[model samples]
Target: MRSRSLFSLLTLVGLAALLLTACGGGGSKKKASSSSSGQAGGTLITVAKGAPSGSPDPQINYTLQEWQILIISHDGLLAFKRTSGTEGTKLVPDLATAIPKPQDGGKTYVFHIRKGIKFSDGKELKPSDVKYTFERLFKIGQSPNAGTWYNVIVGGDACVKTPSTCDLSKGVVADDAAGTVTFHL
Candidate 1:
């Protein structure tokens, strides 16, 4: 009777070990398979801002409708790469391919424009378009968002003056030759 009891106890222990191993292995495989399937991507993001002025032009104030239209309609040089906090801070890269950099004694700056981009009007974006856009911004007076470009480029201050003497001719220059732009301070 003692020998039979010992054999039965060993058999039960072996079975329990096998059951635990199988349970652990099974869970890991299921998790690995699910994670692989979840790697597919197709995402859209929604954001809200305090009342927008509705104008599509970032420089102009229109209405909330216009602001929404602009947000959807336009892209910038570089967008905020990320957002943080409860204020819903975000990364914003609009029309630029990369951040601008100064050259030639801080008087000249160059920017590389993103390729294969188009405007809402179906216009292909070129360095010239960027030149025109910045030119327009300067002509319109200091935008409320003036700080966006103020320190980034030179002549931003003069460009904001009323009946502005902002010498755009000497300031913003487009190098169609290289598909790059240069801003002379």
Candidate 2:
């Protein structure tokens, strides 16, 4: 009788352990499946602020609208190269085929533009566009939001001669002829 009782107690303990293990495994699997399902379909992001200052130009005010428009409109040298989102929002090649670096004196940086990319108005994005954007910011003396990114480029100060000239030099150059841009700095 004593032997039978001990055997029964051992069996119950083993059964309880097995049951707990099974429950834990099922819960983990369920959580993982739910998380993956949620992420499988891309996410939709909405901002409270309405459309920005109509101008998609980044040199203007860096408003919420402007930032959204830029992300939607223009391509940068190295876009969200370190982004934490979907393929579209992920940091990938944008206007440039690849991010270029300075070869000579760490001053002259060249960016190779991607072919066949067009603006909303059906205009091709050339290397000159990049150059013009940089120059414009320098001319503006401040970012659309009053920040200073223009100063980082070479010839930035020289580009800012007068207000009109400043506008011309506010952005980086997109040279159509060479299919690349060389930032002075």
Candidate 3:
């Protein structure tokens, strides 16, 4: 009998919550609304307080909020599909021409950099930038998951220890002429 009474109380509370959520009544502040016109020049005011705590540097920022913004602005060798449900989880080539098959017993991966892609500043993207980016990530040593996720690269352990002199030459090799960046794990 006690369990039945408790269940009834829970059901009432759940219904109340659902009704309140549906009503959304409280403040008199008018909510901002937007319409799609397939054009730019509009204000997008997001009230996200306390997210993306640090600067917007890709190597240093590790929060989910930062990633959400960064993913839209940046492209990596590979990236997950930006879709809903299971399709979004699939990895696809972003800057690389195609995903290279793992070589040397799954210890090495060679990515052929996509040609003609330019940065926001109109600078051509190069394979050397990929190498430099990873090296900078280690050198900074501020990203939360750098050690856990990037330590698999060669010479990463030393970088984790001494960030000032972090070197990933053996780990990340960039051939500018060939337009390729190779990673040795």
How many clashing pairs per prediction, in order? 19, 31, 0
Query: Which tens-of-lDDT digit does each residue in 1-185 have in candidate 3?
Result: 54443333222212111111111113344775686655678887464656447876756655677666655556666666779999986656667777677677666778897787766455787788778777777787685655876676799889999988999999889999999988787
lDDT of 1 by residue, 69-106 (tens): 44444455443333457433333333445554445644
For model 3, name the residue pairs that clash. none
Scored by TM-score, the top model is 3
Displacement of the residue 98 alpha carbon in candidate 1, Å: 3.6
Better of 1 and 3 by lDDT: 3
Each prediction's whole-model lDDT (CA): 0.47, 0.46, 0.65
Cα TM-score per model: 0.52, 0.55, 0.72
What are the C-alpha RMSDs, in order, of all predicted structures?
25.9, 24.3, 17.0
Candidate order by decreasing TM-score: 3, 2, 1
| Segments in model 3 whose C-alpha atoms lie over 4 Å from true places | 1-52
* Runs of candidate 2 exceeding 4 Å displacement: 1-45, 50-57, 63-69, 82-91, 140-147, 166-174
